[model samples]
Target: MFLASSAKPIDESLQNLVVEIETQNPDLLVVAARQLRYSLQQTNIELTITEPRPFNVLEEFIIRAGIEFEPAPTPQELASLLGLDPVFVQSTIKNLQKLQTLAPKSPITVTEQGRLFYDKGAVPQPPYAVQIYAIADSLGETVNFQAEPLNEVVINLPSLTSILQLNESNNLISTFNLEQVQKNLQASGLGLHVPETGKIVTAFRSIGSTQTIWRKISLFLIFDSTTEKLTIHLRRGKQMLDSRSKWLDLLLSEGKISLDTLCKLPNESLNFEREAAKKYQNAETAARLEKIHQQALGNSQKKEVIQLRDREINQKFLEIINTAKQQIIIYATWLNHLNINPEFIAALEALAKRGVSIIISYGLEWEPENLLEIKEKLQAIKTPEDLPSVQLLGLEEDVYLQEIIIDREIYQCGFYHWRNSHESHIPLGELVYQVKKSQIIQEAYEILSTRCQNYAQKLWQQAVEKCDIQLARECLCIWGTLGKLETSLNQIQKNNWLELLPIYLNVVIHNLKSHNLADDSPILQSSLLLLSQVEAEAAFIEQLRLAYCQLLSAIAQQNPDTALNLLNNEVWAQFLRLHIAAETDSPTEFISQQTSQPKTKRKAAAPSTRNKKTKA
Candidate 1:
């Protein structure tokens, strides 16, 4: 028996010591008379018994008597409160003082030796860390209680008799608290409700060189209302573990326990081992399929390469010509390399003779030295009699790259001049791929073919136009002056000369107005002579004046209305005075000077006309 304070009644002190002893070793018992005699000797003093037995019977007697004892009450109130009691309390204080004198004068602190003795004899050790379980019964009613190591105890006792007996008899039991049990279960990751059915179950594994190992365990707890009791099952494993009828009802209402304890119960099923083996086999099969796909892609890319040198290209040209069946599209910036090889021409002639269409597309700005050589080579090939066509198309100077797509299947080498010369060669190989008919590919081919034909035709027409312009410029230079052509224009017949006369007169007028020719020069005199020789009707003369006025309005460096008025007056006076002077030999020079003066003044005043004419 042990007591907390000397201030407590003698009987209560005796009962507290007895209760404390019986809690650990509950079978012990003590006589009532002997407990009374020991308590009466100590008024307000603590007493503890080192050896006591039959603790249960002593606990029962103490509970029936209703003795009261208080704890240390935060340790500070102990001495003052105990001193207020008369009689044996004073004697107990004196005894403590005498014991302290015999020991060291330092404060009375319990050493480790004293603490060990106190713990061994004074306190009841709990059997285990008590856990509370809240479970639902078959009727859906919930029950919660604490399990002490092995014993399960209800939360509340009905009377003191039961409390004293249980406290004295059990070393491993404690009262239950539901709130504490809920906190523990939440920490353990066993959620309160079961999850929905058919969710994808996840399992984790760590792969090694020779084998794999399962790393963590998880499962979706599935509940069925028809079963009337909850059962434990594995989602990644196999069969459900059957429930113990008593424990199943207890766990559902109570909540959780150690997983080890649940597994040790009598009725868990053994089929879950088989399910794990099946999952491992499936993982091994997936690894093998990825290896086969990589090998096929590697072989396809190794077949094609590029040929860079002209000599290698010429060598391959024979092979290309032999293989071509339909149309050949050769796109190159330089025609110099092809002109140097005679076999290339013979092969092309052979292909054309076989009735294949040959189209060679190359750049237009060929240097003169290169052009002479190219022309010479081309003249040597006789036109094949049986071939449907052979055409040479020139691309604009801005275009780059030299590619030849033969029969739309073989893509031959691109030229890199420094790396591969005619004397030293490198054969970068041809790329060949089969064309498959699909909507996207068909549309792309149609667009590219139309664009290529249109581009080629536009370049050919421009080249012809440029040649004609160059020839006309040379003829003008050979004739010594444009004025001589104007003099020859008068000899032509009137009806045959109408269009050419107006054009020649406007050219002379533009040159004189721009000061390119002096107003009294031979070109002006010849133009006037040509106009004079024409059989001039009044309506014809008026129409010519109006046409001249409109042309002046278009090119004049002044406002169009002002320029038109001046031009109309000047042209009409010039025409009328020319005929009048020819018939009457009298000149109307003042009228010409008056009309021409207004145009000169207007042109001088408006500087913006220069910018407007430049834009035009």
Candidate 2:
């Protein structure tokens, strides 16, 4: 809320842009700023640093000579023993005496301190003052800390929410370790010797900390809308930060600005009650919708090009999602980017709750951590029943196309990166094909479903055969939480599925117990949950359900006196325990390839005659 003061003049071009934007959009107020105001406490910290100072050759010899002699020798006696000048020996003795390492009297004796010095090769310097400057945002997130103050202008601003966060944030102070402190000092022209690779020999400690003081630093602010919160674009002197700069990345990460926050900010102004109405009233949005409506009325499969940024695509996606009845198919490059938008995620969650089938297929390789992140987000919104089948499958081969087909009706394929694309940077006219043709829609659906689902099923079988527990678990997760492997099975093949179910469960249990993981470990729980949700024959499904319950109970009760005794008596429980124990004990082998692998030689289902169509 801090504005530029009389100390600085605003640029004429920037002023014109602001005025023009404000005139056009009454809900938005553009402002040009060069300074940002934040509060801090100026703390005077007293630090004690221990440095390793190597002893000189003469000092080392003098101390060693004193320790070797039973009766401390006089300077003249020492000079005679060493075959050196008496005057030089006397001067060295005087220096040691001043340091309290040698007796001041005639006979040179190694004092208690001098003996310690001789025992240790290096001298340890006492506590020294080290000035450290650190800065944290209003949210108490630690950014960069340097020796010189990044913000030197001190000013008092209007009262605001100031979090008193020193004691609670003890770890913030710990960020300035001995090595880091030395670097900051050296950067500030303190002339501290900094090693290029190894640890700094100097040690540091703080004493008598001072209170923090507030300061105002110059930073560019470009606010186009009063209704939206600010998107921080950090400034370095006169130049703006590059998009790929590491420092900018650090600030973005520390600030916790999600994709949703960047694309669509929350309405900050209370000026308008009917925000939805105002959104529709915007000419740009109305034009886009009109074009889509016209396309729908025309030839069902005719292709058309549309220009939209990442944020616009999100808006269009929401429209399709909200209106979706049966299914939603999304084929993208990666999931982490799409998952960044909380609003889009929320919509998907709502659709899942409503029994809408959601199939997400990604082409690029997703890291284990990113996969876990996607799983957790989806898991949080999963109901106890896990309705509306949500499946995230990866296509291993190269997939350059980005497309979305909602209910086999609307199809939109584009060059845009979708969720990962930068709104400000992406040029206005990127090509995206929009079509409403029933034939094309069905084709896209088949391509996505047949490819992704088949890949997932294939991966599950391969992982099981290879005894790759990690990959097997991942495939099982896709099968259990999201979608069923929709391959047709005969009576014999169905039985094989049932037999493989226990082995899959056993493999998972073996993995958990191998790691000494707890009974309620996410891995164990998720594996069980996924198995329980698998769609199969009545008998097979029932067996999986009972096994899940028994394993959970048996594992939860470590003691034999409790439900462990009862659980042990259960037939399925005994089977599962023995199966897991056998697999765990062997370590290398699991269910043999003969029993676990199901033959996927089934015919594809015929395409439906009735075509439910929607326009792009």
Candidate 2 at 564: error in angstroms? 36
Model 2 C-alpha lDDT per residue in residues 290-409, reported as the tens digit of each score: 555455556454444344454576566678778876567777766653534567778877776565656677777854365777766664664223222456666754445667787677
Question: What 10-residue stretch in candidate 1 is worst by lDDT?
Answer: 33-42
Model 2 RMSD in Å is: 23.3
lDDT of each: 0.34, 0.48
Candidate 2, superposed: residue stretches over 4 Å from native: 1-311, 336-339, 366-375, 387-389, 418-429, 466-495, 499-616
TM-score of each: 0.23, 0.31
Top candidate on lDDT is 2
Error of 1 at 532 (Å): 48
lDDT tens digits, residue span 336-407, model 1: 534345566677666655545555656556544557666555544432321123455454532334445555
Candidate 2 C-alpha error for residue 430, in Å: 2.4
